[model samples]
Target: MKLLSRAFATAVAAGAAAALVSLTGTVGATAAGSGTAAAPALTQVADEAPGYAVEDFAYPDADRILAEQGIVLKRGDGHITLAACGSETGLLEVWARSKDKVCFRVSGNGGYLSLEIPSVYGVKGNAYATEVTMTVEDEEKSFDIAKNTWTPVGESADPNGRDHMLVEIRATR
Candidate 1:
């Protein structure tokens, strides 16, 4: 029985040795210019890595929106977004002579959008406290809108009733 166990252990040891030699031989051959491809260098791997994504905050599909809707949507924090009027309740509404009506959906703790809509006169606020900036010629004016109510803005609020272009909107909950 002792001789049988000793022979089995010797066979197992020889098998393990052979496996180690086979593995090392392949690795050594690869290292010693044996036609096998080497691992990529750190610099080469880094150079092929994907680039970092950077957000410009510019409005997406702005040209299409401007061409289709006749409204210039420049940029925003993604909190305020254009929406079709009456699509849903609780949307901020703007009344303009050039565009007639434009609506925005507001979300998050606060929201802001920079845009251009000519001859704006009235605004209907949502749940947020809203403010709008308008420009007439070289003069600019701002109006604070009452929450969940309509407020006269731009040319309607102007003493001289000059046509005003809506430029920016800011809202806070």
Candidate 2:
């Protein structure tokens, strides 16, 4: 009888230990499953730096050109770019200057540009059909520039020789 009682006690102890383990696990699972105030908050980081934005259309070498050439370049569609003067091939040369003429090389089928150059009364086009827009005081004029040749514009086209600013240029293949 003593042996049977000891065996029963051992079985009971084993069952009780198993129950305790199961209960502890159940409590942990229940706490996790509640899903209220159990998850930690996430901190988000910005993809880009603060106070920084990219300007895709801003002119290339703007600071240097503005400082050296005394001309202001604003924005464009990226098909045209400023080039050194006297480029032989594949260039749209603008021969307007207060002291010396400047030029730009244009590529691609067609493109547009916005710039600020005072006293640009004429331009020499390349292989592409070109057009230019100018503003004199409050009057705006659009000129259909000749291809591969110099065409008179602004004050050159105007009998009064009124000064004009070249504002835009468009070229097509």
**Which model scores highest in TM-score?**
1
Report how far residue 162 has shifted in candidate 2, in Å. 0.2
- CA RMSD of each candidate after superposition: 6.8, 12.2
Off by over 4 Å in 2: 1-56, 97-99
> What would you estimate as the lDDT of candidate 2?
0.81
Candidate 1: which pairs clash? none
Candidate 2, 67: how far from true, in Å? Answer: 0.2
Backbone Cα, N, C clashes tallied per candidate: 0, 0
Residue-wise lDDT of candidate 2 within 1-173, one digit each (tens)?
A: 99999999999999976775576654223444542333557877887779968778988888898999887888998887888876557677665657357787788788888998888877888888888999998999999988888899888898899988998999999
Q: Model 2, residue 57: displacement in angstroms?
A: 0.8
Task: Summing lDDT over every window of 10 consecutive residues in candidate 1, give the lowest-scoring window.
Answer: 26-35
lDDT of 1: 0.90
lDDT of 2 at 23: 63
